[model samples]
Target: MKLSFLIKSLAGAATMVAMAGPALAAAQSAPSPVTLKGDVMLEKIVTENGVSKTQLVEPKVVIPGDHLLFTTRYHNDGAQAVTNFVVTNPLPSAVALASESAPGTEVSIDGGKTWGQLGSLKVTGTDGASRSATAADVTHVRWTIPTIAPGASGEVQYHGIVR
Candidate 1:
């Protein structure tokens, strides 16, 4: 299946905002101090000179079980520092989160309505039963950046597998 659609959907759904205080909230009409960019890549293993290396390449198409990497890059464009910056990315229904997320990353299994560590979250099935959420159950991934200095840029990433 072509994964470009999934990637595009994810990029559009990803959000980055500064968790400002009431005073700053009043200035919401003003330009944001932080800018965000999102991308998705397909993971591939290539062999050269009898050595194998994993590479992240732009995703064109993907098959079930293919590994994908999702990343969000943030930059502080304002003159002052930005505090309590949060970045959140919603996963596409075609993908299932794979392995452990980055350290300090919080996950949401309920469509971003609630957030917590994967181990601490729960999911309700159609059968009216609740089960501990797993990586595959993650609907969103987030990272809380305490501070981002002027002109500073950084990125956060997570892994997923095509469903």
Candidate 2:
């Protein structure tokens, strides 16, 4: 009898709490509003040597149909060191990549700005001329990495089909 009474009391308490306040109702209906406010101000430091460079470190060119294994290396010359950086390469309009490497690096089909994975980039029409990236499209190019460690270097290479 005592156990049964305890359970009933708990259930009654729960129902009362549920109906007791707007906070509970709001939490159940939708997540409670959240406000986050903070700021970290740091003086910007500019150094002559703080420069980032991306270059084709290896073989510049390859045969038209051959796999042009071009490796691009990025260097961080900044004293403070940079982190969580992404490296990208845009494929020129005239040329397309080989079958094994049709999708080029960071080549946003939508334009030449945003980049994503190869499979995500859409080729609407293969009619070469008709097949083009438009503003409505969200074509992404292959990014070297999702993130790069500070003061570190990374490389990415891909083949292209010479037009």
Candidate 3:
């Protein structure tokens, strides 16, 4: 698929919201104290000389079975620390989540209504049988940061494969 379309989809799916503390009470007209930037990278294996290494590079085109890395960087621009900050990202339709995720990360299979660990969630098939949800069924990923000090920055990342 075209890289631009993938980038656009990533941009639309990654949304920064759910702020707590004094920042929540700020005027709606004012800009958000937290700034977010999202990026999608293609994972490639390059062999130089006699050794092989994995690298992440900007994707100009992606095909099925290609591994990808999705990342979101966040920074607190507010004067005071922000607590209970949450970062949520939706998987693109053409991507399937990897089997493992960072500890404390939560995932949603039935849209954004509910979230839990991959193994803890279930999905009912069209045949009327319930089955355990797998990484392929993940639709969204979320991370709740306890606190972000003023001027502090951090990032969260996940892996996926093109469908």
Which candidate ranks first by lDDT, i.e. highest? 3
- The local distance difference test score of each candidate is 0.87, 0.48, 0.87
Query: Residue-wise lDDT of candidate 3 within 46-119, one digit each (tens)?
Result: 99997998899998889998889999999999999999999989999999897756335799998888999887
**Segments of candidate 3 deviating more than 4 angstroms:** 1-26, 48-51, 102-104
For model 1, where is the 10-residue window of minimal lDDT?
Answer: 14-23
Model 2, 1-163: lDDT tens per residue?
9999999999999988877887767769752122122221211224457764323333344444433443466655444445445544555443454445444434566555555544565565766544444322432235545444445565555545444
Q: Highest TM-score, which number? A: 3
- Number of clashing residue pairs, candidate 3: 0
Best-to-worst TM-score order: 3, 1, 2
- CA displacement after TM-score superposition, residue 104 of candidate 1 (Å): 3.9
Indicate the worst ten consecutive residues by lDDT in candidate 2. 34-43
